[model samples]
Target: MKIPEARGPVSAGLLDLLSGQPGADPAALANLHELVTVQLRAAGDIIEDEDFQLALFCLYELHYGGLEDVDDHWEWNPGLLGIRQLIEAPFEECLRSAALGCTTETRLPPEGTLSSDDVAAILFGLAAQESGPSMSRYVAKKATLEQLREFLIHKSIYQLKEADPHTWAIPRLTGRAKAALVEIQADEYGGGRPDRMHSALFARTMRGLGLEDHFGAYVDSVPAISLAAVNMMSLFGLNRRLRGAIAGHLAIYEMTSSRPNQLYGQGFRRHGFGAEVTGYFDEHVEADAVHEQIAGRDLAGGLVEAEPGLLGDVIFGATAVLAIDGRLSSLIMDAWDNSRSSLRAAVPAGL
Candidate 1:
């Protein structure tokens, strides 16, 4: 996507640099550092920092699918990477402090205690016990068509490339963990059928709503909270050191997915949309039911079994997913409740 209109000095500077402007000099970097330091020190809310979070999102985007007309070389440039790390270190710390509690009290699975079945049981318990705000329930029973469309827009940021973030772990894992990841990813990749790919199915859902289905088409419209939710996955997935966290994230993601998708599909039907419109959600209702099992048991459970030390990061990842998603859902639902648009104002047409 074209660089989003900047929200603050750092973003403004970065955008100017990307546009080939010459004013983003050391002064801009100094301004960025000061901004981050302030946000880091007295930041009241990590989940809602539109400026900081969106800036970080744009940095991470370079590695995934670089922006149009941006220099590809910037993806690995030391200067850019340094700035990213400066931002990311605080963001990661904020997430950990906000989500994962002290590890000292968390019980570790005893040596040799981790089996596939045991892993499934733990994930199942986590899923069952999670009581996050039910965005899906609201959508099913109370959402207006416009609200549902907005929900789809927020989701499309990630759904359009649904399994790619987690797939980064495929090479980081080995033995049972590796095999299990491949199994789940195979289905996500549509098991050799491009038409059946989850991303394509989501695209169909977007089209059914008369929304744009192209990647990053709605980036300018979504709020930073929405972007941060997706960025969390990419962060965990891209780092080999965070493989356990990614696995845990995926486990919880799948475990929590099935039921909500059922509700979402129902909401679509309630709005008079047919199977084609709801097919993406409908498919998840069935697919995630099975995928959750594999994810929690073989994928997550197996990973911890192989490397017991990763248990804490795994749990941290799961908790982070809950925390971030809960915040995003709360923001959207609250905005709609107050009769405000959850999205930023649509950008002016034709530039």
Candidate 2:
């Protein structure tokens, strides 16, 4: 959880400021903004830009659980927030574009033309119809021990804090939507048993794999595409205006979760691991089946019914999850196919 090595000038400057180094300069904020803006414009694929994505990840981290040993004051620093906005503008645009592309081929019912139940039905139907490359399928059928470990490393970025990003929506919603979210979140939190929490279950999975179980332990080893996947959730969750998007993100996340989790459990069993090693996925298989219904109907659908304007954002958010996740899956599969590690080069021990 120590400050990660800077990936570029913006991250370097931000780190320096956080570390309380005398060399840190406020002027770097403007430089960082210009650098990110120019890079975002010139880049053909922003999601794959390690430096830009990592820098933005660091910026967003300040608002989450801040980096270990970094000053809390940096969270509210005007200069840093200003620079973050510069990075986020294009990132948001890219998300919208990706979402649009994913859903354009589908025939959606006209906006406001459907009841909450109908909207939920449409979302569930669309999720059911989706036919993308299944990372879980590959893991279940063909992954080696090393490959499974690598998969855990990649997943830890989000799983270690599972459901946290979506928690930000609690204050932004009301009535049935709010109640639905709380119900789902309660289960994610293990229903009053701290040890049963999904995050805790994932930690056990990491330990079972002989991997580090601490939060952020693998951050230094993951690539930007991996980080981007989690960062997108944080982005949607943290913005009040993006509440619908976050809800949709969670709905799609649950709807698509059950089957893959089953595959994941099968994969672990294929490797001779017992329930202890497969508990996280095993839990999700059953939990998400029910959660998908609540999320699609009561949560996402109710939210849009309460506020019709958020319908587009809801669809946009759900689609973004699929889009980014597709990219991450493709990256991992490509690397494994080529006999390369999908992670960044591992950090040396005791660094």
lDDT of every predicted structure (CA atoms) = 0.81, 0.84
Native-to-model Cα distance after best TM-score fit, residue 339 in candidate 1, in Å: 2.5
Q: Which 10-residue span in candidate 2 carries the lowest summed lDDT? A: 21-30
lDDT of model 1 at position 293 = 86
**Which pairs of residues collide in candidate 2?**
none
lDDT of 1 by residue, 248-330 (tens): 99999999999999999999999999988898998899989999988998899989889988877887888788778877888
Which parts of model 1 are misplaced by more than 4 Å? 21-44, 101-108, 347-351
Q: Deviation in angstroms for 271 in model 2?
A: 1.1
What is the clash count for each candidate, in the order shown? 0, 0
Residue 196 error, candidate 1, Å: 1.8
Q: Give the clash count for model 2.
A: 0
